[model samples]
Target chain A: MTTNHNQIPITYLRPAKGLATLNLKDLWDYRELIYFLTWRDLKVRYKQTVLGFSWVILQPVINMVVFTVLFGQLLKVPTDGIPYPIFSFAALLPWLYFAGSLTRSSTTLVGSANLISKVFFPRMAIPIAGVLSGIVDFVVSLIVLVGMMLFYKIIPTWNLLMLPIFLFLAMLTALGFGLWLSALNVRFRDINHLVPFIIEIWKYATPVIYGATLIPERFRFLLGLNPMTGVVEGFRWAILGSKYVENFDPGPLFIVSITITLVILISGVIFFRNTERTFADII
Target chain B: MTDIAIHVDKLSKKYKLGAMYERQDTLRDFLTSMVRSPFQKRPVSDNQILWALKDISFDIERGSVIGIVGRNGAGKSTLLKVLSRVTDPTSGIGEIRGRVGSLLEVGTGFHPELTGRENIYLNGAILGMKRTEIEKKFDEIVDFSEVAKFIDTPVKRYSSGMYLRLAFAVAAHLEPDILVVDEVLAVGDAEFQRKCLGKMSDVAEQGRTVLFVSHNMSAILRLTTETLVMEKGRIVKRAPSNEAVDFYLSSGFVETGERIWDVDEIPENAAPFSPKALRIINEQGLVVNTIRSTEEMTIEFEYQLDASVTGLRVGFYLMSARGEFIFTTFDTDEPQMYDRFSVREPGLYYSRCKIPADTFNEGRFVVGINASTYRIRRYFQDERAITFNIDPAGAPGMQWPEQRLGPTRPRLNWEIEKK
Candidate 1:
């Protein structure tokens, strides 16, 4: 059945001859969906609970207290003359956001199996929303961090404005890793058990509870290899200022962090694009 | 735009039959396969692949309501899936010239925990509607769904009928250039189904391309301009709606004792099950569709399982030719029989049951096969599978020319008493 009706645009579906299809334009078209899903996740997150949104602040606050007790009192880990609570809270702000985003984003595809199979949208949107939703929790916890910094009387300087930029880096890091994990999780379920363990091990490698000075100067350069190192130090510099940054070079660490994050994120996008086509069949 | 709204060029999809569970794309799977390579003898081709769509090609015009009809597993869903881009084709191309809206399932993104109001936006976004577009259609969608009162309530609290109504309402208002609907109207009560049919007809009349796949023959006859019959992954025939339904229904009924299913007659949805033959046997064990009513006869259904499926109970329902009430029985209906074949292996199996003498009236009876795992699940059921006539030559009723009312014609002992 054929007729000459010159109205609708032609869309061709065929075997795409390529290693991957980024389809960034399609992603751009469906950008509103990403916003709504992220909003939905944030709205539903704290519903019908006694503590409700307090859980957001309570998680990092409680973690900061535990680290102060163990690392500060028991192990006596140096904080480079900065108060341990503020130091830990400052670093924990970005660290918890990274961890939370990583956990949620990695499972976003698996969680929405019905949507993936039944609807057509950029598959990347689901995981991106997972990372975006955590920003709300991060913003809430940052307020609590500000309150704690006031208690210690260590005022933030010009570096305070760069907190969101560092937070964006953390988001990119989570998304970079999450893109790989979410796409991989669609086929291999082993990623589910592997993520929590990765977060646990990853937290200590960064200077969340302790200061960067705890690691020897000889091995200090190696610490920058961990992407979170720059994020944590970036957060510290932004909130606590360089006086507490302990002569650490923010320039080189920032460059290393941005470079590595970009590489991982771009590669993650390519990998996700490669495997997304078969998600419905496997899922 | 092209003259053809949609052009399908040699569209095909190949799926590995039994290895679906073992389908692995991870490094662990690769490592295991490499580790066992030296010890293994079976080649990769040993994993049999079923071509769900095999070089099928067609062209659909703009603003035409086309219906796809076939027995289950005739690759109808696969065709829709390929067109909707749910899964990519193995080797083919389909040029769809329009903003296509496919309703593969109602409530594609409805979260049970979310309120109906929230779900409208969520489901709309998933359906490719922008925020501004949904905001504009918000009132229209709410009014159409008839859930305006409970739009604030969580959808999990709504009755399933209400949920489906809301879902269908959102989908109805899509107004895409081309609409692909697959059995979505089968939900809800008769009245709602009628409303959906009316709405679908309105959609077709509005000069939008539509591809509808349904088993409801009457609906197909009502709304579709033309129909395509799919059998075993290929379009076997295409004609106007009425004639196509006639050919589709009549092709299943044969005038002989043994009905041998041809390749095209076997449905595509009958995956893992390829029916071989269905036979009617007399007391002496000879196949016969027409048998003496006073003698016992057995009906046997033969099929082969391409993959091993668990808890499969293959049987049939014996009904009258005019589609009256009848008994439904499965192979695993008996206690011991259920245990014996609880886990079915990949092989040929025959389910045969004997019916007592004088069980049917002097007319034709239909045998509808049911293949499922009891109430837990149902795989396939062909209600009008085959028909056979009973010749009551020497029965008690043969002396008189009276027509019986019900399905059974029995010779019960009764004596006339002086009142």
Candidate 2:
């Protein structure tokens, strides 16, 4: 066995300093762990509940109903001539996925304190798993959106291909903020209290309940800075098609949102990597 | 170079004391500190920094089994944590030449909500085993745990013994070029413990380097050839297991004749009954670490009470070097004395017991002190508090050149009635 020592890989451990590389190869090597952990999160999510998977669909549908009543009926909020139920329900799918992934990812590090402190793996897998586990919920809720689309007699178009792209964008945005908040949550438990509040305020800022046209033309760029603005608007555009909504273009808004998301994500990975060494000690 | 499995060079780790309290772990406290920093004149003190491991260097060859022995807080766990990469060292470097599997704890990532089968995979992955590897060894692991029937049941529903066995079984199957283990044997029953030991010996037989840390002297002596004795934050002695265990058992305390309790060493719950010191006095009335087997010796315990304690008994347990209990004696063992001192007053007191002449054989003896109110509360206990050696030259066995077997050699009258 000693004769084949050259074939064995060596790992040198030293203190991390300054900015560390993202080490994506390490993440690639542990891809199976990411899968197992994501599987675990999905399996354990609704195990004992009576409603089980129904809660996934009910959450968005119930929110869509309340928004339709408040904005569509009494307030008479415009949906660009698209039916209020289908319009808002389309946006709600991505928004709820983003919110759910964000909340779960931010708490992932603290929640898996045992794994972090006891074992060595790519720490990034934890939050990534957190973001990935929400996809089942997103896909399940998308079925309800399809049912609503059928009810509204909306025909599928080439724009339907863009749904996955926008959903991926939503996942990236959640992962970006999730990495940042989860790493911070280890040292400052205040992040635990702060995440839900952020989600609550972030929902009203995005165009989930109403159309993006509600934002005045001049301040639309400000809306685009919220990252999810583009994702939600893009989801509506992709599913409802350009003909359903009036003069709604996701071009400039996507540029702004994608740029912000990439910046957050790249920097979030850097910050998380730098602080990863101290997590076991502090957490 | 190929033979060296691990090379640790001047590695050290420093931890800030009261880290959670001193560092702002909350946003409110952090922001407040940030706002107040400009006006604050004093910097943080250096005394709060503790070097858990200091400038330690060692090299272990492949296929060698090494043991680490130390008292609690002596950096045994810290060293293992650093080598296993659970935490980073403050300075220097450690190079490993092969895949490392560390068992700092058993079933580290086991989830109560997951079935035992699910946990095996999760825990195996967490311990650095591949999924296919786990799948291949799945049947062997389940058989080892003896929980095949309950493999699908959530681990929370399993009995505690079954839980521990399954956890250890998964850990036992971890095949890595180098293995790092802590006090995992401290759990499980005696029979299960023997099985774990057997499995570990098998791992050792496969020519893998093993770093084992345990307080069980017998386990260390049996499994390891070379042992490292640690004190404070550095390796003070590295020798064969016999010499290392002897040195550790004899000089591990603050001093040989007496042990003075430090304020930090005493837990807050000890409360009203605070121990001051424990001492061993000889016939000449001098504190000593060695005495003749024929000479009577006194074991004294001094403590102070802030409030009166009812039914308080102060006693000491005498054990041989192998941790076998010889006997336990209390200051109030006599019924008359128990009645008189049933209620210990709020003041300092000394409780002493004498071992009669010809009581002990020629070997090292350990004394452990305990103070408790019967069936109510245990004030304090310091097991292995102090150790002393006995010389059999002056005892009844001096005429025979052969050593006596057993912990004690008593002088008893024998009559030749058979003839």
Choose the strongest candidate by TM-score.
2
Q: Write the per-residue lDDT of candidate 2 for residues A102-197, one digit (tens) a residue.
A: 998999789888778777788999999999999999988888878888888888889899889899999999999999999999999999999999
Q: What local distance difference test score does each model get?
A: 0.83, 0.86
Off by over 4 Å in 2: B20-23, B38-42, B256-319, B323-362, B365-404, B407-419
The TM-score of candidate 2's chain A against the true chain A comes to 0.97
lDDT of residue A14 for candidate 1? 80
Off by over 4 Å in 1: A1-7, B23-27, B34-43, B252-419
Clashes of each: 6, 0
Name every residue pair that clashes in candidate 1: B72-B269, B73-B268, B73-B269, B74-B268, B74-B269, B257-B289
lDDT of 2 at B86: 81
DockQ of each: 0.60, 0.55
lDDT: worst 10-residue window of model 1 chain A: A1-10
lDDT of 1 at B302: 90
